[model samples]
Target chain A: MDKKWYWGIIFFTVAVNVIMLQLTTRAYLGREFEMVLPYSIVGVVMAGIAFFTFLQWKKVEYKEDEK
Target chain B: MSECPKSRHANKSKNDMVNLVDNVEQKEDLKFNRRAFLKSAVGASMALGLSTVPFSVRAMMGLTDDEEDRVEIIDLDQLPVGESHKFYYPTEKDQALLVHTVDGDLVAYNSECTHLMCPVFYQKEENKLLCPCHKGSYDVNSGQPIAGPPQRELPLIEIEVVNGKVYAVGRQFRHG
Candidate 1:
């Protein structure tokens, strides 16, 4: 995959996670809900997946360059 | 007497080694300073950000508006058991609901959904408060979202009962 695409995906994932966190906190404040923990965990997992995928993509590029 | 070539080479190598050591020490110092600067910068920014939040929000999870003129105290007997009464407390624009649960616990929350600020309705059949706009369900007792997109627990309004009269005393904002 293209490096730019990988970077774009990373940025987009981070942005989405941040927006979700903000919305979650706002909702919690408004309602005093307890689901913020689960939402945060999901956000963290999504971020990890995105990061892992980006790293894998970079590894593949490195291997290609070596060849 | 001319210095031996070997001695000159040895001196040159020693000078080079000294320069390398100095360069390494400088780089290490730079790294330490950079880290210290970033840490302080981040700490300062975080403190500023936290302090900037509105005082009303920072007070407590259940403290409402401090403005006495905007609060309207209602009687508890006015609302029957297993039913909810919608009223405006603190401000006319902000609507709140006082729900008398089947178990006889009185709970108060903002009738607005935490997700999109849409009004939420009490569902007697489901025994859950429903946010029709987003299908969010909140447990009537805790004002916690049991399902749907809303992540925050409902803002809890503190109430006091005296001689059958209910007064909206404070509001609490709960976060996860």
Candidate 2:
């Protein structure tokens, strides 16, 4: 639990993906085809970060009784 | 007295930090502690990220070529300066306005207000488009929202003058 970095990374991914989704919607509605790809790419990259961070967190949280 | 007979684990003690009122049981803690929170957060992030994929897909589909839709709107001589004419361009359902501004610059825009699809009127005296539904206003030349609840600019209509006739050639959504 000392490594709160896991929480930080997960939360950061959520925040970035939230913004990416909003930008994607606006661009889509405005018919800005050029902007949608970059927003979608950022969203997918943030999702990857979130998945890997969860794996790391699971390892730390479910380790054997090491006391 | 000796330790309570009802106790399941004989070694149970406050110092042991196992299954006490202040301590969570291992199985329950595993199900609803930091692990659960992180799992849910990751799920949300992944769901949100995947949600954007559809928008990208639709954007690519919308990039297809649109047919040329040139339609005669009105005669330039019929619509004098400082006056406005209402017409439909590209489609009959789309209501548009052709404005001959007081400054004599010919401009056109889809009259539907960006806020709520309410039709906006050309205020020739003030040189602005006014939406009665929400008091939204737009610049006659740029179609950008000037005030009120509207946030986006009106869709601009591309008009060309040919032999004293005004024709609507193309339309721009979310124009400046």
Candidate 3:
């Protein structure tokens, strides 16, 4: 896979994290547990995914030079 | 020494397969764990939403938004003489009490303590409404505070018995 593909995934995960964070705050303020729980879980999961994708991007850039 | 092309091709393919498996097992970290996350998120949200709903919202949810004028209190046969039932009347925030003083005689009143808004429950043994907060007591028959800090009577709840069912139709508060 191209190094650029991993970068794109990283950006996408970051976007997801931001959106979920906003949703979580709204739900908390509204005092709607129906929205808060799901949004918090999704936000944390997206953050985890983003961290892992960043690691993948680093691995892609520093691959061994094939002779 | 000359290597056979077929054997060389086979060796390369096996190495590629091994590398592919290793990459999938160790380095493919961006895989979205959709199934597990979805299961946990949905289960948690539903459990919390159902359990933690505020009392007011839960009451509103029980009755449809359009129909707030009338609320069913209880069944007539369920209330025997000398027993009282606590329920909501007029609105979800308003509490009311229903009692069958005697055979074929049903009475209802707002259960809030007129002095401080504390909930009042019927004491069947004493046959009076007792507010545990301040020991305020209201007469079960007249709803007038007979003892303690209460200064007024509990609002009367007009009850309607339709086809063996009891409904709180309206409320009457003390004038002046």
Which candidate gets the maximum DockQ versus the true structure? 2
Q: Going through the candidates in order, what fraction of the true interface contacts does each contain?
A: 0.06, 0.79, 0.00
Off by over 4 Å in 1: A1-67, B1-72
Give all candidate RMSDs, comma-separated: 15.1, 4.2, 14.8
**Model 3, CA-based lDDT:** 0.65
The residue ranges of model 3 lying beyond 4 angstroms of the native Cα positions read A1-67, B1-68, B102-104
Candidate 2 clashes between residue pairs 3 or more apart in a chain or in different chains: none
lDDT of 3 at B70: 73
Tens digit per residue, CA lDDT, model 3, A1-67: 7866655665565566556656654444333445555665665566566556556655654453232
Docking class of 3: incorrect
Residues B40-106 of candidate 3: C-alpha lDDT, one tens digit per residue: 4434433332332342243335334343367788888898888888898777788888988744368
The candidate with the higher lDDT, 1 or 2, is: 2
> Ten consecutive residues with minimal summed lDDT in candidate 3 chain B?
B13-22
Per-chain TM-score of candidate 3, chain B: 0.58
Error of 1 at A33 (Å): 18
Give the alpha carbon lDDT tens digit for every residue of B50-158 in model 1.
3323322443433452453324457777777788889876678878898888878888887888889999888877778999987899998888899999877777888
TM-score of each: 0.48, 0.83, 0.43
Cα miss at B14, model 3 (Å)?
99
